[model samples]
Target: MLVTGASRGVGRAVAAAFAARGDRVAIHHRDSAGLAASLRASLPGQGHAVVRADLADADAVAAMVDEAAAALGGLDVLVNNAGQAYPHPITEVSYREWQELWARTLAVNLTGPANVTWCAVRHMLARPPGSPPARVINVGSRGAYRGEPGQPAYGAAKAGLHAMGQSLAVALAPHGISVASVAPGYVQEDETNASYKVPRGPDHAAQSPFHRVARPEEIAAAILWLADPAAEWASGTVLDLNGASHLR
Candidate 1:
C-alpha cells in the first residue's frame, strides 16, 4: 500500500493502521524526509519505506508512483491524503493573491491526485489478474458540501476529487479497481493542537453537537474498512464523516 502525505495528521494515522495489520506501506512526502523516515522506522512491521516527490510537479508525481511500486514490491492500494487548506476569502485577498491561492490549492489537491491515480491505475493494470481489485481511497473534505466560502478553492478541489473518483470507479470497474472518497469535517490534528492552530477553532465541539471534532484515527478506521475486498460494492461512494455537523 502507498499513502501520500503520510508524514502526519490523517495520513499518518492511515499509514499506522495499515502497518499495524502487517501490510508494508510506502509513505510519500514532498519535503518531510526526516518525518517520513522516522515514521517508517517506527512502524510495527518492516518493509515500510519513504518515497519523496512534489505532488504539484507532474514529472515528480509520475516518478514517485513508479518508485513506490518498486519499494513496496507491488501497489495494491493508494490513499490520496495529501491536501492543503487555507483561508483565501475573496473579501480579504487581492485579485493576484486570489489567483495564486486557487492555483496552488487546485494543483496540489486536484491535479496532483489525478496524476497519481492515473499512474497507479496503469501500474495496477500491468499486474496479472485473479487477485482482488486494487483500491484507491481519496481524503476529501466536508467543505465540498457544507461550503468553504473562506476557501473556495479547497472546497472546489475536494468536490472535483469526489467526482473524479466516481468517474474512475465506473471506468476502472472492469479492471477490478475500486475508487472511493471520504469527506470529513473539522478534523482535529490531535488533542494538543492549539486553538488557533486549527482552521475553524479548536472548540469545534459545537459544530457537530458532539462537543468534539473528528479524530485522525476515526477517519483511518473508516478507510481501513472501505479498503476491504468486501467493500468493492461501495466503489465510487463519497462517505460523509462529519459527525452530523451538516446533514445533506
Candidate 2:
C-alpha cells in the first residue's frame, strides 16, 4: 500500500494503521523527506519505505508510482491524501491570487491524484496473481458539499475528486480495480486546529452535531476499511465521514 503525504496528519495515521494491519506501506512526502523517513522508521513492519515526489510534477509522480510499486513488490492500495490549499477567497483576493490558488489547488488536489491513479492502475494490471487487490481510496473533504467560502478552489477540487472516483469506478470495474473516496468534515489537524481552537469552535462542532471535529485516526480507519477487499461493493461510492455535518 502507498499512502501519500504520510509525513503527518491523516496521511501519517493511515500509514501506521495499514502497517499495523501487516500491510507493507510506502510513505510519500514532497519536501518532508525527514519526516517521511522518521515515519517509515517508526512503522511496525519491515517492508515499509519512504518515497519523495512533488505531486504536481507529472514525471515525479510517475516515478513515485513506479518506485513505490517496486519497493512494495506490487501496488495494491493507493491513498491519495497529499494536498494543498491557498486561502484566497475570490471576493477578497486579487484576481492574480485567485488564478494562482486555483491552479495550485487543482494541480495537487485533483490532477495529481488522477495521474497517480492512472499509473497505479496500469501497474496493478500487470502485477502477478495473489498480489494485493487494486484499490484507490481518495481523501476528500466535506467542504465539497458544505462549501469552503474561504477557499473555493479547495471545495471545487474535492468535488471534482469525488466525481472522478465515481466515473473511474465504472470504467475500472471490469479490471477488478475499485475506486472510492471519503469526504471527511473538519479533521483534527494543524490545518483545522486553528478553526477548532477559535471562538468559532462551537459552531464548527455544531455542524457535525458531534461537538468536535474528527480525529486523524478516525479518517484513516475509514480509508483502511474502504481499501480492504470487503469494500469492493463500495466502489463508485463517496463515503461521508462528516458526522452528518452537511447531509446531501
Q: Which model scores highest in TM-score?
A: 1
Candidate 2 per-residue lDDT over residues 204-231, each given as its tens digit: 7777777888888999999989998888
Backbone clashes, candidate 1: 2
Clashing pairs in 2: none
Q: Would you list the C-alpha lDDT of every candidate in the order shown? A: 0.90, 0.88
**Ten-residue stretch with the least lDDT total in model 1:** 190-199
Query: Which candidate number maximizes lDDT?
Result: 1
Worst 10 residues of 2 by lDDT: 191-200
lDDT of 1 by residue, 1-248 (tens): 99999987889899999999888999998887887888888899888889988889999999999999998777899999999877899999999999999999999999999999999887888877675569999999999998899999999999999999999999999988999999998777743233325565646778888878888899999999889989999999999999999899
Roughly what TM-score does model 2 have, to 2 decimal places?
0.94
What lDDT, from 0 to 1, does candidate 1 have?
0.90
For model 1 the TM-score comes to 0.95
Q: Give me the runs in candidate 1 sitting further than 4 Å from their true place.
A: 191-202
